[model samples]
Target chain A: MAYTISADGLRKRYGDVQAVDGVSFDVEEGEFFGILGPNGAGKTTALEIIEGLREADEGTVSVLGLPPWPRNSKLLPRIGVQLQASSFFERLTAREQLQTFASLYGVPARRADAMLEAVGLTAKAGERVEKLSGGQAQRLSIACALVHDPELVFLDEPTAALDPQARRNLWDVLREINTEGRTIVLTTHYMDEAESLCDRVAIMDAGRILRMGPPATLVRGLDSPARISVPSGVLPLDDARALPGAGEAADDGVSLVIETRDPSAVVAAMAARNALTGVQIHGATLEDVFLELTGREYRA
Target chain B: MSTWQSFRSLGRAMFLGFVRDKGALFFTILFPMMFLVIFGGVFGHQSTSKVEVVEIGAAPLIDQAVARDADLRKTLKVTRYETRAAALKKVEKGDADAAVEQRGGTLDVHYSAADQVKAGTAQGLLGSIVESANQAKSGVAPTYRLAAQQVEDDSLKAIQFFTPSLLGWALASAGVFGASQTLVSWRTKGILRRLRLSPAPIATVFAARVVVSVGVALVQLALFLAVAQLPFFGLKLQGSWWMAVPAVVAGVLAFLGIGMLIGAWAKSQETAQSVTQLVVLPMAFLGGSFFPLDASPGWMRTLSYIFPLRYLNEAMLNVMGRGLGPMSALPQIGVLLGVAVVASLLAMRLFRWDSA
Candidate 1:
């Protein structure tokens, strides 16, 4: 398979900090790839190097079979980039902002209106960009990136600081863009965002990828126990602990929690006892994998 | 994408932004216009008031002239003093415009040099009075006669000087403040980074910005000329006044370069604003925008040459006010362009795409 992006041992440093230390990754065509990390995990730095916005101290990056550094004009027209901070020309309306980008890319003016509609910003098209809500402006920026219909797009923390509802709305927009068979590379600190959107994710910390794999596969690899819980009054704490396949049990006043490798077995035992009321089963997720890999709570 | 398309699109967007900004509109166009109205009202069509002359001793010539010419009596308000020292002290203290005494075959006129305009007017009136007296005493038909003529139309008023000087001031401030503020804000706001990621060349983006700035400056020049030409202001455009166009372009380019330099170096909008003010305010004052450099002290006149606005003011004044030929603007244009080139080189060297 032809890879859309190939980066090898990319390294960058700023003063005393090693911003990107021996980072390496490859993205397949049409894949929704993500670089997940905390605020200072060097995701933005590495993305910038690949986007040709900054130079790496070492290693190489190739996008669309061309070097991104030195600002390859050929690659520029083939790829889109949405920076972490959404910036528009001063005092421009939402539609005008997209039109300006479209024009810069030599796209037709009509594409601006279409893109605005696609982003569900047609109603706010006449309003100045400054007047747009944070989510609306974020949507406008995505439309700007996709206005020219490039085959590949990069979004740097596109959903940071957004309300939950807006985040979900933007997720739909992003998924639609990816559904159109465009390769997407995103950098985000949100674990659920990476788990849901990315085909594969690289979890980074202190400027190095600690692990890289599919979210489900990574979670499965952790081999962590699942927790099954029921309302406190559903069963006594001692009775929950004695249940079949229940490795450990505790009552935290609200619920009786049982840690077990076989969650189904514990649920069956609870059902046999008519104690399955409000039962909730928690499986291992990417968050758990992050905690296992870093040996600390996930801060973001 | 073609550079032309990028330039056109970006230029249109920037122009829209500029026009929509009421603060920029007021500062760039109306602010200088206010100065023009104020200066023009005070100085335009100004005629010298009666001169207070102190007569020292034995000035029978002046008495006879005043008695003979009714205009002289009205023009010169003569006060007599017992001693020449007292008369000279009156002139020195500005209580009298001039002190005059008869010195065998010649008349001595002592005028304070503080007010060049008023002193020059008094000296001219007295010299003419002496000339008429000499002519009357000779009583012979003069073989030759001296006739005085104005180089420019008599309609030229003080508005002519204020228009060009104030226009130059306006253009300089607008170009510098506009460029610097735009650059710094764009950088801090991440707009520069956005443009860099676009397919449009960075050079094309800046070219578009420069085109819009120059276009706005031209509009400012046109508005200033039109307003000054109104009957109330009485500004008469000279034969080569069109030369101010090229001068204005050069001046804007120079100021833009300085602004870019500040923008590239400053890390924040506040810093850029303060620095631009530091550069522009001094340039306006030292550039003879508020007053004529001819009346300035020798040191100040020399200092004015260091400012680019001085060249712009001088160049526009040459063609628009003094009615000098277009060639007179060439040297100033050359200096402005040279400054533009040098400052641009430095700005390029200092240019940063991001505030970080």
Candidate 2:
């Protein structure tokens, strides 16, 4: 399959911190690829490196079959990017802001109004950017990114800080863009959002990918004991591990939630030990998988 | 897109954004006007103060005394009127600041209090001269008959001296603060980062700014000249006043470069504004915007030469206020150009698209 973005052995460092350590990934054409990670996972650093906004200390990246760094003059025009917390020129109307970007790309100014319409900001097109609501400004930002109609798009937290309805509305816009056969690569901490919109997701942590696969496949590959919930210190620390099917238990502040294969056998043993007062059994989730792998809870 | 096309599009968009910004609009149009009105009100004409003193029966006697006593000729301007009614009419018409009538060497001073400053000055000088002239009534033998003659000297209005410095400060604040804050704000807002991703050159945006600044300065120059000529200001156009055109352009170039350097070095808009204040406040004070520095301390006058604003203000004054031609203003122009070149180079070296 043809790939839209390909990177290998990407590395970047800031003084003593290794922001992105040897990250490698391939996003195929027309695929909705998502990079899911908790805070400080180096997702944004990697995305910036691929977008050519930043330089990788050691790596090679190709976008649309053209090198991005040292500036592929022709490559920038063919790609779109929406940065996290992206701001715009003050006092410019939403339509005018979009048009400004379009003009820089040498595209028609009319495309700005069209994209505003596409993002359902047509009514607010004439409003100043500073006057727009959070959701409206976010849509305007996306519209500016897509005003040029690039073949590939990159969005870093496209719906971050948006109200639920606004986020849902933006998701529909992203889906429509995908329906047009354009490839997309985005980063988010919301696993459900990734599960719903991404064809394939990469779970990243500490600058490395812990797992990469379809969300369903990744979840199905996990053994039984989908999810376990109990108060901390409910069972003797050593005793819980000695149970029939209990794996390492991780406490996520509120409760000690652990992933295990055989939930019934562990529950029986815990009940006999009188440690089942708050014990509960539920289906496994991406959060459970993350806790089992990374030894840290994922942000809800 | 071709570079030309990119420039046009970006320039047009920036122009639209600049004009639509209410705060910037207020600064561009009303800020200088306010400064002019307030400062002009505080200090009246400083160059040459004109006072019309109508002489009654004392006309020929004062004329003779003025001719003989050179000191009297310098201080008192006695315009002889045939009748006291005619002299009072001139004072009422404001063609004269005060009226004076003399009968048998006892002078009666007639002055309108409408313009208290001018009238007070007239009263002090004429009041003393008339008191001394009446000494002949005090049984003191007259040593000799005194005669007075009037001659117009180099007395230009305070408004004439004030106009240039006010314009300089206006241009400096608008060019420096306006450009620097916007530059820093653009970086903080991610506007520069987004523009960097495009194929267009960022120079187009800055070029538009320079163009707008020069245009605004030129408009202000015309409006100021027209307003200052009104009866309120009573400013006289002396020497090569038109030479201020070049001075204004040079001023914009130098100050715009300084502003760009500040913007490039500042990490945020607030920092940029603070830095601009640091430069603007000092430049205004040293450049004689608030007060005349000609009679200031020697060290202060020497320090003024280091600031580009000083050159801009002095160049404009040489042409419009001081009786000097364009040739005399050459040194100011040369200094401004030198500063512009240096500042532009520094700005280019320090400018950054991403926030530090």
Candidate 3:
């Protein structure tokens, strides 16, 4: 498949800190591509480089077959963006803000109303932006981003501050837009959001793409198919590891955890011994893949 | 919509934004007008008192002669005083100009030195008394002319002088603050970074904002002019409104251009605000908006000439208050245009769309 965004050996530095270091990735057209990492994992920085916002120190990037900088004015109308910290002139009504954004792309007047309605902000269009609730303002921001009707849209942590219902509403709007043959590239820290919305995700850390694949593919690649947990005092660690298909076991204070390629076999053995009372088994998930790839170190 | 259409849209947005901002309007219009009315009323009363002088004192013998002289009685509204000290006290406080004391043939005249208007009136009275004494000795009298000079009255009140300037300050401040603050906030918000990936040119965006700001300022000036003509102020345009209009507009752009430079270069909105305020407030005050420059210190007058506001006020005051034409205002216009060009060029050079 052809890529809509392509970058090679991208590097970016902020004074003494390497914000992005030797990163590379490709996003295919019409694909929901997610850049995922812990905060400060350089996910945002790498995405910015690919978006043509920052110049890579020693890398090349092409978005829609054009260099991002020496900013290509001719290419601007083809894309939409939702900034991490979105804001507008406080006194402008939601309708006015949308209209202004539409004008920036030379879009028709009616497009603004359409975009606002799409974002479910048409009812409050007359109210000033400052007066809107956080969720409403966020919806207005999204409306402004879509007013131009670009083929590609970039959203950064768009649903971070939203309530669950609002987040779901945004997801539906995004899905509708995606169905219209537009590509979406998003950055997020929420694994669940990344898993559900992205067709493929690039896990990043220290300015590097540690792993890249579909959520299911990444999880299946883990050495352990399932993990068993139990109270730490319930079983001896050596004995738990000796179970059929159990590769290792560790005491986790309240549970004795075991990794197994076949959790059914391990459960059958536990049941044969009548030792299933305190055990729980779960398939490997995106979080396990994330923790394995980026490590569990706390980032500032 | 094309690029130009986008610009028009942004201009509309800015205009609507300001229209809804009551605080901004208050400072731009009502606050300045209030200052004008209060300052003008207080100062106008003081000015009128100096123009209408009261001269006191007379020898009873000369008073009889002066009261009998039809020519003298018609021109001078002379009042009798109980004591010479009382008359001199009034002159000293600028309430009266001249006080004459007569003992035999020697006449002593006292006048206030603080007010130039009072001093000039006192001098005229003294000259008349000297001439009248000489005429009396020669057994002849002098005649007075009753014709007034045809100087058309375009006397500007304090409000009339300050309204245009307050509007200029508002426009310039909004332009500088809007662009500079918006840029910084957008950067902090990661909007600029996202925009870089798109095909839009940052330079084009900046240019559009400047264009919008200048356009809106012109409209705001028209509003101020209309408000000046209301029944309360009774302002009249002495010169062609044409000359004053463009001059005021150019002045606003010039200051806005300078503000653009500060906005484009400053790292943060806090820095931009301080820089713009530091540059704007002094110029607004010393440029003769709130007060006339005639009696201001010579150094201050020389310094005021350097600020775009001063030249703008000069051109505006010339046309609006002095009835001068564009040709007469070319010098100030030339300076402001030069300022606009220089500021624009510097702003462009200093502007950075990214975090660089």
- Model 1 alpha-carbon drift over 4 Å, by segment: A297-300, B48-146, B150-157
Give all TM-scores, in the order shown.
Answer: 0.88, 0.79, 0.83
- Reference contacts preserved by each model: 0.79, 0.64, 0.67
The sequence of per-residue lDDT tens digits that candidate 3 reaches over residues B1-356 is 36676666756766687668787667655665566556545554342233233334555544654666875554455566777677877778766666777767766667666877667866675566666666778875557634655454634555555555555555555555555655665555455554454344455565665666666566667776777666565567675657876786677668767876887788877887788778878877888776777768999999888778788778777777666666766788789889988988998898666654
Task: Tell me the spans in candidate 3 whose CA falls farther than 4 Å from its real position.
Answer: A13-21, A57-59, A163-165, A229-259, A271-280, B50-123, B126-208, B219-236
Model 3 / residue B93 / CA error / Å: 7.7
Candidates 1 and 3: which is better by DockQ?
1
Clashing pairs in 1: none
Model 1, A220-278: lDDT tens per residue?
Answer: 99899999888888899888888888898888899888999998888888888898788
Q: Summarize candidate 3's per-residue lDDT along A112-226 as a digit string, tens digits.
A: 7888888888889889888887778777887877788777788888888888888888888878888888899988888888888889998988788889999989988876567
RMSD of each: 5.1, 8.2, 4.6
TM-score of chain A of each: 0.97, 0.81, 0.85
Best first by DockQ, ranked: 1, 3, 2
Clashes of 1: 0
lDDT of 2 by residue, A119-223 (tens): 999999889888998888888888888988899998989888989999999899999999999999989988778888999988888888889888878877765
The candidate, 2 or 3, that scores higher on TM-score is 3
Which candidate's TM-score is highest?
1
Model 3: how far residue B306 lies from native, Å: 2.7
